[model samples]
Target chain A: MHAYANPARFLRIARWLMPALLAGGIVFAGGALAWGLFYAPAERLQGETVRIIYLHVPSAWLGMLGWGGIAAASFAEIVWRHPLAGVAARAIAVPGAVFTAICLATGSLWGRPAWGTWWVWDGRLTSMLVLLLLYAGYIALAAAAAASGANRRVAAVFGLVGAVNIPIIHYSVIWWNTLHQPPSLSLSGSSMAPGFMWPLLGSTLGFTLLFGAVVLMRMRMLLAGAQADSRLRRKALSAGEAA
Target chain B: MLKPKHQRMVLLAAALTALLAAVLIAAWALRHQASYFYVPSEIKAHPPEADRSVRLGGMVRRGSVHNEADGVTVDFIVSDGRADVPVRFAGIRPALFVEGSGVVAEGHMVQGRFEADNLLAKHDEKYVPREMAGMTAEQARQTVAQTK
Candidate 1:
């Protein structure tokens, strides 16, 4: 991890890796979506509405994974002061929020048919909404810190503090009697049939790859911006000396 | 005194522990509020005040669903394997609303019958292909009965 703290080295690796991930993501996500949408049979209860699970589950997973990444990056930023840690955390915020929003939207769509409502204030739904809000707050706080030249640690600390909500979101169904169903997949096994589970897994992997590609793309852009800012500062310093 | 690096780690650890503790305490306090609905067993064990509106959630009792003469009102019993609450709702039910499934109704008790103003269906976690779920109605009823 420390070895890649050097920006140039990180950029060199990411250049090739980004496109590779993007291509793999497209292939897998496309194939999985095709399979899920057309090939997989309708669920016993939910019928065609269950097809939404292919998109919904992956977005929900990635949304949570994004925050988890931010929290880990925040930890590194605070403790080790890894130079790229802040960049990684900042890069994750927007995509994470996007995925969270997607999760909520797809969930609302699924609920309208299967659960008979577009939205409910159940434990699962509410906690996920809170996660989205946390993502928004993190993005805004990070931006404000950047603009004001304030300590980035403030945003980093917020990232770490907000991580407590992750567990709450995970356990909300078990902890409370909710309108939302409990997890279909767990460490023990899946409640879903092979016809559904395989494509769902494929879709999850595809989306995860896509998420990684997007985050890397954002990190590279942020790093380039930082480099430009520093170069401008240096040029100004030299011109002032000459004057 | 610890080195700055160690100091930061210790501080982060302490801060995280404190945050987790605070959240745990808050969740413990808000457990009842956090739960979206109460089961029939809970209602039977400790009924709420007459005027307070609360959500009641449980399985729709098999063979208990009845359509009233008014055509809008429907009567059913919600069961949680331990207790049962008879509910009456006068509204359009959802597409998934059926006997032997799960439902959540929001209203208050009036003369031992729950008068529900809103209803939302709940679903189970199982997701088998429709072809594989060609169980006879008797089999479906038995499954619900056994689960209940």
Candidate 2:
């Protein structure tokens, strides 16, 4: 991993990797969405409203996974002080928040017909909302740190602390009798039939790939921007001395 | 090179202090602000504050829904198999709010009766994804009932 920490080398490889991930993500996600919408049968209880899960579930999963990545990167930043860890955390933040917002919006649309309400302040929903807020806070903190070139520890600490919500979101249904249904898929084995599970799994994979591609693209942009800024700063300093 | 040892130490201390503060605030808020709903069995075991808003979630008991002539005021019973709580609402009913399906209502107890201000229907047993298609709502309810 450290071998890729060299910015120029990383960018060289990422330039090729980004398009591959994007194309793969588009194909897989688009195919899964089409399959889920057109081919899957309507649920017995939810009827046609069940189609939203193809997008909603994956976004929700990515939302949580995004924070989990931040927490891990924060760990690296704080403990090992990995040169690329902070960049990785910053790259994941905005995309993660976007996915969280998508999850909430899609869940609301799905909820109207299925749950009868657009939004509920139930444990699961509330905790998920908090996760989104946490992402926003992290993004703002990352920006402030970048502007000041301050110690990255502040954001890393926030990243670690905000991770508390992830477990809470996962267990909210069990701890509280929420309107949101319990997770169908878990390590204990899924309650979902294979017919529905296959498409959902495919969509989740596609979304994860998309998320990875987005993060890589953001990291490369940040790297290039930093390089440009430093080059400009050196030129200005030399011109000042020459004058 | 890293920052001076003292600078690093101070920053680490500051971060720890901030983290501690956040943890304390979260714990305090969650204790008071978090609202957990109860099923009928749980409600019966220990009723919550009658004046405080709480959520009551369970299946809509079959044949218990009574729509008043006003068409806005409706009465129903929510059951968790072992116990039941009667809920009354004076509002527009949702299109999916029906008998023998899952429902969650937001309200507090009024003299042991739930006076719900809003209703949220639940898609219980829908995520199962097998034997659901071609089955009408009633048949699905019966299948769920038989399984219970």
Best-fitting candidate, scored by lDDT: 1
Question: Which CAPRI tier for candidate 2?
Answer: acceptable
lDDT of 1 by residue, B28-124 (tens): 7888889999999998888888899999999999999999999999999999999999999999998778888899999998878889999999988
The per-candidate TM-score of the B chain, in the order shown, comes to 0.83, 0.63
Question: Could you report the DockQ of all the candidates, in the order they appear?
Answer: 0.57, 0.32
TM-score of each: 0.94, 0.83
Which candidate leads the pack in TM-score?
A: 1
lDDT of each: 0.92, 0.84
In model 1 chain B, the worst 10-residue window by lDDT is B139-148
TM-score of candidate 1 on Cα atoms, chains taken together: 0.94
lDDT of 2 by residue, A40-86 (tens): 76675667778899999999999999999998888777766678899
Candidate 1 residues A1-243, lDDT tens each? 799999989999999999999999999999999999999889887889999999999999999999999999999999999999999999999999999999999999999988778999899999999999999999999999987889999999999999999989998888889999899999899876778888999999999999999999999999888889989999999999999
RMSD of each: 3.8, 5.3
In model 1, what are the clashing residue pairs, if there are any? none
